[model samples]
Target: MNTTPSYRTIAGDGLWSNNLGLVQLLGLCPLLAVSGTAINGLGLGLATLLVLLGANLCVSLIRHWIRPEIRIPVFVLIIASFVTAVELLMSAYFHQLFLILGIFIPLIVTNCGILGRAEAFASKQPPLPAAADALAVGGGFLLVLVVLGGLRELLAQGTLFSQAHLMFGDWGRGLSVTLLEDYRGYLLAALPPGAFIGLGLLLALKNLIDQRRAAVAKAAPALTTQQANTP
Candidate 1:
């Protein structure tokens, strides 16, 4: 039997079981800092996703040439190169959202999620699986960031997708929805504390869901055995 993990297993790990945000808890800095609004989260999330895909593919392609002693530095250089490219692309195309993302855009260099995947999985795998892993893991982070941002924005301003023009161009301006007209915003949900509280709630929900799934999986075997014995 082949011991190597299949593409599906790697994707599953990245998307859910070993998610960088909900499970591994990597990349919290960007995750929490820019998630105050849905648009902000989306901008940064897309940037991170692009960087991850590029870095992972590059690392996997060059893994054989990388020596163990110098792998860390090489990985950093590769990731930084990709991040800079992404930053420049954003600045050129989405100048407004680029400014809004600010320092965090460059800060993708230090995102443990990217570097960790490069070291742990990408360097040891082929380009295709590495790319798949990047898609799944980056997607998972993007999903969490967007959800958290939307939740915080809804609570703080009673609006969803506020400032739609940042990422989506002028047409995005019409995307903002007012959930409660003339409603007072919740200040806490817009603050750093709000990020922490919101993240904690999300973590709790993820754990609850995982536990339920595990319980069901555990009972499934027993059910199958009992049905077979009954016959």
Candidate 2:
């Protein structure tokens, strides 16, 4: 069996090769639901990042003591505890935003991304590296959420940071940045169907780019071979 990978490998895997949002496609329910606005997405994404980091750290620290038969349950328990803490903190501090998040906030316990990281990476690595990996994965997931949220918000409302004060302080109330005054909001872009459609288009665009890159790589080899034969 291989030992723990280097930090560079962990970062690359979490950010790209094994991205929780884009590559692995884990945790779609909340990812789709709470990403309607940038602030909503940012709140949930930050909460998830905390939970992931906490869960991974706990799992890594205790992996050796836990038996194979009971490991999953232990991991779940650890993750659930973190989720509960996050929920309570949100309710106490950001009550309005917490209410808006509702069931999705508690549902973080069931996110496959958290459990998958626990079993796949944390279970096999040390606490420090596992924590780093969680941060990387969580950051990548947050990036996707924020971008998707911004896209939906811009298309649907023609404004960014419309509700910044909900999560931030009173000073943030003035941070609402309007993109267009004459803009007519796209109702479809603010709905559930719009989230799905936007995500699909984003995925398609990523695939198209990958395909184009591959085609260029293939052509480069063929061109080199033809030039070598000509000379």
Best by the lDDT measure: 1
lDDT of 1 by residue, 110-189 (tens): 99989999998889888888899999999989999999999999999999998888778889989999999997999999
Candidate 2 clashing pairs, residues 3+ apart or interchain:
none
Q: What RMSD does each model have against the real structure?
A: 1.7, 2.0
Model 2 Cα lDDT, one tens digit per residue, 1-231: 749888999888887667788888899999999899989999999999999999999999998899999998999999999999999999999999999989999999999999999999899998999999999999888887888898899999998878899988798789888998989899998999989987887778767877898999989999999999995
**Candidate No. with top TM-score:** 1
lDDT of 2: 0.91
On the 0 to 100 scale, the lDDT of residue 20 in model 2 is: 85
Q: lDDT at 228 for candidate 1?
A: 94
Clashes of each: 0, 0
